[model samples]
Target: MVAALLPRERLLMGPGPSTVPNRILRALAAPTLGHLDPQYIGYMDETCELMRQVFQTTNQLTFPVSGTGMAGMETILVNLIEPGDEVIVMINGVFGGRMKDNMERCGATVHAVEIPWGQSFTLDQIRQAVADHPQAVMLGIVHAETSTGAFQDLSGIGELLHQQGMLFAVDAVTSMGGHDLQVDAWGIDAIYSGTQKCLSCPPGLSPVSFSPLALEKIESRTTKSRSWYLDVSMLKNYYTGGGGRAYHHTAPINMVYALREALAIVVEEGLQPRFERHREMHQLLRSGLEELGLEYIPDHSLHTLNCVAVPDGVDEAAIRKRLLNEFDIEIGGGLGVFAGKAWRIGLMGESASEKNVLTMLAALKKCLGD
Candidate 1:
């Protein structure tokens, strides 16, 4: 081995992998527990219960799937979409596009309803699509488009889908813990989220929940799920029953430990208070960005994930590099159609503190020399 790695320490206000809390980091070092150990099983059940509180759902099919956020996306598609099923995917940002790709890969016919990047889908458009494709089995969209920081109205879209008898699925990878996401209240059939964004854990696990109707659809599928590991049928049994010890995979023992500690912190702080913290930090950042004469692409739909428009005569990449190298502050560059135009600043979980907000604003100001 060469010299040990010396990574530069920076305020991670990027698209994801948000700054983790010290307590959660310490928990990652606790003695590893066997996957099926009785104590570990108890921890697992407790984690699921806490997730239900965060998700604001009583859906029994909720748990942490042992992979990244994308795993949660694939889990819903593979388990629910049959070969000939129709899926209407509302595409506004990269994550929505990913959902469409995942659905198509599952051999389902994907009807993509496109919206401009940095914008959100409207309920009228969704209802029109559902009417156009009467046989659609599922409708999918990203609740918070991380690439654009545009939050779609999940309640409106979910209600429209529910009225049409279409299963509502959302990629809440960046929204779950930061924003108000009541899965049952919104009538969401299937939802997925990553631990890193707002949960403040490392990015190894995806927390997913399925409504009973969605589970019924999965159960009644005529074709076997394309991916065996992601199939909810057997995994549900393993996670929910028989002592809550199912050997789906290794289960990432240390990562699970980190997530449990992170969720514990969330519960201790309380979800409502945590959401308010994120909202407050977001407002601070927004005000600072406006003071610097920068504007957001989507003015009305600003999320806790703030995307600021890059100013004229600025090299977006070079400025980000200089900020990291000189000030030890990390912010994300734009993606897709918004590339070279914006920066995604995440105010989530532990990173949503006032100190981080002020630090990032000062660093960004210095970078812009303003």
Candidate 2:
């Protein structure tokens, strides 16, 4: 017989799906509404406005796609790249590699710039890649490489690419609310982010934004996006256009509720203070980990996700097991090249608190002592 589903609750300190606030959970359980209901459409409009504020952009093409972060990636790529177009992909971690794969699937010729897993790409390297591929239509990069905790700087890359008449795209899934990102100020043409990482919400919706330049490219596509499900031109009409509440696919209404509440909390807290909170929490964890003779992996690490090298003779998997089974705390394991050699400890959104940092540090001391 199929039994009722119930999962044990633990402190979520992993790379994503951070602890949700109770208010957002209550919002998720609110009355269900039809996709085109006037009240529901009002909610959708308000949600887009909130996304614009959070993204620090005035772009009119901002909306939450009814899928995970990967869907956002596909949406941006498929809508912009037609067959035979050239693109420059920055691959310093797993997510960047995924971007390259998706670009290839869109039939774009990818010129990849590889870097060590725990390192961010240099401006000179990106400039050189652009010179090598002058015909590139876009440059795709990850702002926060979650797999290795490397924080890539996007300060000048946007203007550089825009000067070359190429689009500036970024994957900010792990850094959105936890780090500093000014979409309009930074000249980011198109960007996407996940709810779970720093929004203290579930992993369902991906907030995406496209500048007018990007929309123009989509409008000029030689062919329709290969994936109709992720086609942005049709999506904009449903999200906000002359069609007026037109139905595409059924929107994830409950996830939308949760996201709205989360964004409200972000507004209430303010962005700068929230980023400072993440910084302080990271410092606490870094000092404690350093005291225990642990070394950080990333050359320039993300304040939200901390990747540390596993000490010699210590069983990385066993330590993580003890932290979960004994302490009821959850952290992430490293991916790709850092697998088995590094542990990822995330201080993101609601989980980036002084108590959690101290608790994790003390718990780790006990486990290591044993």
lDDT of 1 at 181: 90
RMSD versus native structure for model 2 = 0.9
Give TM per candidate.
Answer: 0.96, 0.98
- For model 2, how many clashes? 0
Mark the 10 consecutive residues where model 2 has the least summed lDDT: 239-248
C-alpha positional error of residue 50 in candidate 2 after TM-score superposition, expressed in Å: 0.8
- Show model 2 residue runs off by greater than 4 Å: none
After TM-score superposition, the amount by which residue 138's alpha carbon in candidate 2 deviates from its true location, in angstroms, is 0.1
Q: Please give, for residues 1-370, the per-residue lDDT of candidate 1 as tens digits.
A: 7998986656788988888888998988889999888888788888888999999999999999989999999999999899988999999889989889899999999999997887877678888899999889899888898888998877677777877789999889998888889898899999999999999898999999999999899879888999988889878876787544557766778888898898888888887888888888888888998999988887445456898889888999998998789888778999998899888888878888889888888888898894
Query: Cα miss at 255, model 2 (Å)?
Result: 0.3
Instruction: Write down the TM-score for model 1.
Output: 0.96
For this target, which candidate reaches the highest lDDT against the unseen true structure? 2
